[model samples]
Target: MTLEWFKSSYSTADEPACVEVSWRKSSYSTADGPECVEVAPTPSAVHVRDSKNPDGPQLTVAPTAWVGFIRGTTE
Candidate 1:
């Protein structure tokens, strides 16, 4: 499963600092399907969100937590 990375940036009204994130859709998701999930991994955290809604809410977790979750799912 080859994941394509796309960079996105967003800035809040209070913070002038621009945050950049690289998002990639899950390999299990189809091109024309509604059930799509995307993930962005940073140095400190991993962000997860729905591919259909890029501007929607996101779930962020620590890198270690993300690894544990992946291992748990695989096992």
Candidate 2:
């Protein structure tokens, strides 16, 4: 999958550094289906959003928390 970086628009003068995130579609996702999910992983956290609605609300979790979640699901 190609890496696509997006800059967060929530940056302000006080926090001039904008967050750049690279999102990737889940391997289980299909091109012609509705079960689309994407995840962006940074050093500190992981960001998740629905690929069907790119501009919709997103869910962010800490790196360790994300690991636990993945492990839980796989087992």
Candidate 3:
């Protein structure tokens, strides 16, 4: 399934410097913070980019790798 792009939860309304992600969440909620990595997930991989430069280069990794990263970070 193709997920829609959404602003990160760490982003605030006043700041144009935001990160957008394709997280499988129900609402288009933005977080309260500044620059962070943005993530967009696809069927095969997860796309990651620097929030400061949306038009810049992105890094793509397998979904499994992404999951492992998340797990590693949280634990």
Candidate 4:
């Protein structure tokens, strides 16, 4: 299957240097590098995808699951 990769705008001007961290914004999308992180903010889940590698795997987490992660980091 073919996947459409999206780039982020929040990304830095030097994209090559910031390849791994590239992510597309769900809002304003264009032919650019990652803006920051693709957020599919729903009541239950949060989705993240790679800007450079759209067909690549994604990271999906329940909103509560992510909260747990953050809470863990605080300790």
Candidate 5:
């Protein structure tokens, strides 16, 4: 399955001439080049989605569930 990617909004340019910033996120690349995903967290849940498909469906989970998943992966 193809993972849709998204870019972080924190990127910026110092030069006034440069108006556009390239996509950058916690991403990895296949032989096919760079792919990314962005996460937005809320008080109640964490939201995840493909950057390339912003209008598409998102995966949301409770904050506790998210913490458990992270701890599980790290342990």
Candidate 6:
């Protein structure tokens, strides 16, 4: 199935800079702010784009790969 794109709730409309995340409700979303790097809602696969540049191309990747990337970057 094709996933629909969405913005991350964690993002603030106030901030000029926002990072779009592929959001999955409940699992990723919460009563609090949503996760970062919003992608199209779908299965394990995630499609990510920059909210700063809506017209920019997206990066598609598996959940594990995404996790590894974040882990690597933060480390």
Best by TM-score: 2
List model 5 lDDT by residue over 1-75, tens digit each.
122344434445653342222222445634455555656666666776766665688788987887888799799
Using lDDT, rank the candidates from best to worst.
Answer: 2, 1, 3, 6, 5, 4
Candidate 3 whole-model C-alpha lDDT, 0 to 1: 0.71
Q: Please, what is the whole-model Cα lDDT of each candidate in the order they appear?
A: 0.78, 0.82, 0.71, 0.57, 0.58, 0.59
Instruction: Kindly provide the TM-score of model 6 when superposed on the true structure, using C-alpha atoms.
Output: 0.42
Count of steric clashes across candidates, in order: 0, 0, 4, 5, 3, 8
- For model 3 the local lDDT of residue 26 reads 21
lDDT of 2 by residue, 1-75 (tens): 234566678777787768777788887888787677899887777889998888999999998998899899999
**Error at 54, model 6, angstroms:** 1.6
RMSD of 5: 9.3
In candidate 2, stretches whose alpha carbon ends up further than 4 angstroms from where it belongs are 1-19
The candidate 5 region of ten consecutive residues with least summed lDDT is 15-24
Better of 1 and 4 by lDDT: 1
User: Candidate 6's residue-wise lDDT over 24-62, tens digit each?
Assistant: 333444445544344563466666765444457878899
Which candidate achieves the best lDDT against the true structure?
2
TM value for model 1: 0.69
lDDT of 2: 0.82
Stretches off by above 4 angstroms in model 1 are 1-19
lDDT of 2 at 44: 72
TM-score of each: 0.69, 0.69, 0.57, 0.38, 0.51, 0.42
- CA deviation > 4 Å runs, candidate 6: 1-41
3 or 6, which is superior by TM-score? 3
